[model samples]
Target: MIDFCNVSKVFNTDLLKKDFHALKSVTFNIPEGKTIGFLGANGAGKTTSLKIAMDFIRPTSGEIKYNESLGKNKLEAFKNIGYLPERPFFYPHLTGLEFCHYMGALTDLSKAEIESQVNVWAIKFKIDFALNRHIKNYSKGMLQRIGFLATLLHNPKLIILDEPLAGLDPIGRKELKDIIVQLRDEGKTVFFSSHIISDVEEICDSVIFLKDGEVVFNGSVDQIMKDNIKPETRISYFDGDSLLTEVIPNNKKEEYLSKLLKDGKEIVSLQAEKPTLEEIFYNVKKN
Candidate 1:
């Protein structure tokens, strides 16, 4: 688990020049064993928060604590964390297997352990056949898969993935989602950033929405949807071979239904359109 307490990051580090506040007193907690999505538009500080959490960059005015009982040593905590950046760089000359072995060594895994773990993840990601190929020859999807495999090779307790599904095809995305679900089932915590709202909706138990370098929302996805539910329900009916539709406030549904029946219009269908994550995201951003 991790906590960001009043965290703020200012780029340019100067008062005279135009300074950019990447994070504005952001505060949140990442609970254990939960898949959390960091959602934001460009320049919303999603990546900045993740970088601060990972200690890639120091926060300007706040503290990030990870499992306080584990002590204040960041490297000790990082040993249990696996991270994949948005655009992962790979060794061009190393084959996939060679790269995995190289990274696995950094985690202090034995050669046998590295090979076994790599094999398991390779099969899971369907990249077994390509492991012998050179990294420079990999396509975007293949590179992403290899990068993902490297991230999981050590089986870290917490996985931090930045845009894990970026550039992946539909199948690749589905495969990654399935793997993420498996990790969650196995009780591993997953924190990821994504531009794809639908994927976040499908995979994240909780989501954090950022706007203008601030936290706009942070809670369960279901609760956010419920809180932002649309106030109107739509009704469709037929009036002498002509179809007509009406949007009525939720409280007036019964009244409108009664009026439609009294008017002698044959009811075609009646349904309430649920608010989607995308709609809720835009609404939050607009506000």
Candidate 2:
């Protein structure tokens, strides 16, 4: 489990005394065996939060707790965590296989284990054929795959991916999304941050929305879907329909619900509406 306590991060510049609060008193817990999508804009605190949890950066003011029944060390919290940053910085001289092997060595994996894992994930990421080529020669999508393979070589329990599908073509994005879902099915706890709403809507068990360095929403997709409006028929009163006595006065409380359920018989839609993820996102921001 990971917890962010009263977390806040600020970056300052002297020119205008600009202080961008990346996170604002944010607190959330991710349980085991769950896949979560973190959503926010370009300058939002999504990266900051992930970095703090991964111990890549210190929070300006707050506490971060990493609890592992497996007794993973603080600095070694990364041992059980797999992370792929926005832009992976790898040695231009190293081949994809060489880089992954180096990462495995860094994690203290034995030669046999390293070789087996590297080959497996490389094939899965479609980088096995690119193994001998220098990383500098690999395309953007191929680099992303190599980065992903490098992260997963250690077989971590928790995966943190940043914009994993950022620059991929449509097919590449779909394949990557499928791989994410497959990872979760294998019981690996997954957490990813993405600006793409459609991707999140499809795979996330739950999401926490950040806006201006604050958590604006924390709930399941269903709650987000039905957040604002009640599930009832909308009535536009007709001139001859007795001006709709179905107002059901509040003083008579029991009668209100009864009248609503009984008399809300006819309704029309501006269109056959489905409160999609985009709609829910709008509701969160609007509220």
Candidate 3:
């Protein structure tokens, strides 16, 4: 678990460049065993916040507090946290299996342990056959899968992934999502940043939206949709040879439906318009 309290970060080390504030008093809490999505567009401080949380960069102000158990030593703390950057760097010459073993060693795992875990994850990810091939020969999706395998090699309690689903085909995205869900089922906390709202909607229990270096929204997806999206119900009916449709406020659906039936209209279909996360995200951004 992690907490960001009024965190702010500014980049101005270069005298020739203007100061850029990547984060401005962004505050959020990541509870354990939950999938939390950091939703934001490009340059919205998602990566900046993650970097600050991992202590890769120092914040201009505020504090990031980790669980007491993971706060004592930096190296020890990282042992329970797995991180996959937006663009992962792999040893191009190394085979997938060798890379996994190398990453496992960095995490202080024994050879036998790494081999066992690699076998299990390779099969789960359906990349067992590609493990012997050099990483340079793998496709983008294959590389992404290998990155995920490396991240999970240590069995970290919290997994931090930046744009994990980006650049993958639909099937590849589905596979990665399934793996994330499995992590949740196994009680591992997942904190990932993504611009793709649909992916977050599918997996995240809670979401934090950022815009222009500010925290615009932080709450459950359902609550956000209910608060930001207008309620509407649509009805379609057939009148003789003509088709008619009516859209009404959700609160007045029952009253309007009765009126339609009383008017001898043959109702063909009735449906409530549920707002998608994409709609909700855009609505929030516009405001």
Candidate 4:
């Protein structure tokens, strides 16, 4: 729902030190109703890009164009965006329900509307049982869950999550990922940043990879995986009550499979090896 066109950001420091280039002519599109993963390692400008998109930090050069669907003006558009920062601060003394109410009030939501949204989302997020408990008593995952519930209280069309999965346990990660997918199914545009490639690969329909303040790759996840498929195939077969596994070159796979079949070996399984997103990410960094 947003187009980042040739965006660049520079942080000027002391005269003795050089300016830091946080982003270098980065360009990408967050299409409507799609779950887009902003992938990058630490200090790779992922956060900078999101900040620019949110208008939290101005880009030194270039601009971000919001689709008219967001609103006619910037203020109206921003109202339609739900954002959760990487290190969100919450009132330690406020209970979860109270926190949600406070956030909803900022969004101009009425008390009744806030209460209704919280009732639905808190249950779905699995944090409803603890809504009356103090925030300081919540675990890391619980904090993240409450943060998300608060973000969605307004039902924004576009949800921008900065490192949403960071510091989450495996179960926490899975729960958040499932929520992201649910948002997609409900036709919400989600652009989330993360250094975790496996989590992104599992849930993102498409991904934008940033390396050193540059856009390295931006396209469909399936297409990228297909393009980076390994040039070998793995096979498993039962031979004399023993299972044998082998990896063969793509060119020799057919020949090898034929030989095994001709020899009466029971073929157990055949799989074409493919590079994981992590592998591809390392390769991108090396390049």
Candidate 5:
């Protein structure tokens, strides 16, 4: 398991003479074998949290700790981790195969092992053909595929991806989503950030919604869907003669709402009044 203890981050801008609190006292957790979707708007400090967990950047004040020291080896912590940045920087001149090989080498894998693993994932992602082409010629989706293969070559237990579905066609998006589910089923912990709600809804077992620099919610997707904390529901009938008060009574609002929709009995409109992640984030900011 990973823990973020009162983690906070601030950035200083020389021109403005002001500080930007990218994250403020943000804390959350990712239990093993679970898929967590970090949902938020742009500049929500999701990236900062991921970076801190990976040790890419030290927290401004707080610390990130693990359950067991993965030995005294610093890189060993990475042994169980695979990371893909929001926009992964690649050596443009290197071919896709070369890049994977390089990452494998950095992880201290044998050359033969790199070749074997790279071939497996590269084939699965259908990027084997592009493996020989220079990365400069790769499209955004292609680059993401390459980055994914490189990250998975070591078979890490934890995978952290940032906006991985950013620039892909519909088919590609579906394929990657399937891959994420496959990994989760294999008992690997998957953590990623995305602005795509449908994707989050589809693959994530739970989510951590962030705004500005704080965590607003951390729980299962079902909890957000039920929205029991602030219960609300909408109902409408097709008949113009039907009065609003008759179709919707405050006392029976939620119960009748579901019953009417499912029974398909002349219901003109229906809406579940649960707050979306976006709404929740804005509400948190508002408070």
Candidate 6:
């Protein structure tokens, strides 16, 4: 668990350009054992925020607070964190298994522990068969899979992933999403940044939506949807050989449905019009 309070970051560019404000007093919380999605478009400060959270870069102002459960100090607490950057560096010559071992060693995991973990997760990640092949020979999806294996090698309490689903095919994305759900099931805290709104909506309990370096929304997915719900009902009906669809305001829905029923039209389906996360994101951005 972590609390990012009013964090801001500014980058100074050369000569003619003005200082860039990558983050503008952003604030959000990563609750313990929750899958928190960082949702934003490109150049929207998602990566900057993650980097600041990881302490890879210092914020220009404000502070990030870690729960004592993380550790007594920063160094000790960081040991319990597993991070996968958007573009992770890999040794081209090293085989997948070798690469995982190298990463595990950095976390001070024993060789036996590393081996056992690799054996278990490799099978789950569907990369077991290719573990002995050089990473250079692996495809992009394969590389992402290996990177994930390495990240989980230590079983960190908090997993921080930047664009973890980037560049993967649909099947690969689904596989990785399944792995993330598995991690959440195991009660691990996952804070991942992604531009993919639908994927975030699928697996995340809560989300932090950013726009142009500002915090637009931060809370439960259900709450946001509820807040922006459309006050309309959509109905489908069959009349003789034809099917008709209608959108009615909530106040008039019952009256409209009664008339359709009185007309002897067969009602096929009726439901409230709900906005998707994508729609909500765009609406928020536009406003």
Report lDDT per candidate: 0.90, 0.80, 0.91, 0.93, 0.83, 0.93
Q: What 10-residue stretch in candidate 6 is worst by lDDT?
A: 81-90
Worst ten in a row by lDDT for model 5? 240-249
What is the clash count for each candidate, in the order shown? 0, 0, 0, 1, 0, 0
Tens-digit lDDT track for model 6 on 80-163? 999998966589999999999899999899999999999999999999999999999999888888999999999999999999
Off by over 4 Å in 2: 70-72, 228-272
RMSD of each: 3.0, 6.8, 2.4, 1.4, 4.5, 1.5
Model 5 global lDDT (CA atoms, 0 to 1): 0.83
Cα lDDT of model 3 by residue, 1-287, tens digit:
78899999999989999999999998988888889999999999999999998999999999988886555667777999999888776989999999998999999999999999999999988899999999999988888889999999999998999999999999989999999999999999999999999999999898999998999888888787677556888889998989988889999999999998899999998877778899888877888
How well is each residue in 165-218 modelled by candidate 2, as lDDT tens digits? 887999888888988999999998888998888899899888888887898877
Clashing pairs in 6: none
Candidate 5 lDDT tens digits, 102-159:
9999988999999999888888888999999999999888988999989898888889
TM-score order, best first, reads: 4, 6, 3, 1, 2, 5
Q: Judged by TM-score relative to the true structure, which candidate is superior, 1 or 4?
A: 4
For each candidate in turn, the TM-score is 0.88, 0.82, 0.91, 0.96, 0.82, 0.95
Error of 4 at 235 (Å): 1.1
Residue pairs of candidate 4 with colliding backbone atoms: 1-30
Model 3 / residue 47 / CA error / Å: 1.1
lDDT of 4: 0.93
Error of 6 at 211 (Å): 1.3
Cα lDDT for residue 187, model 4?
Answer: 97
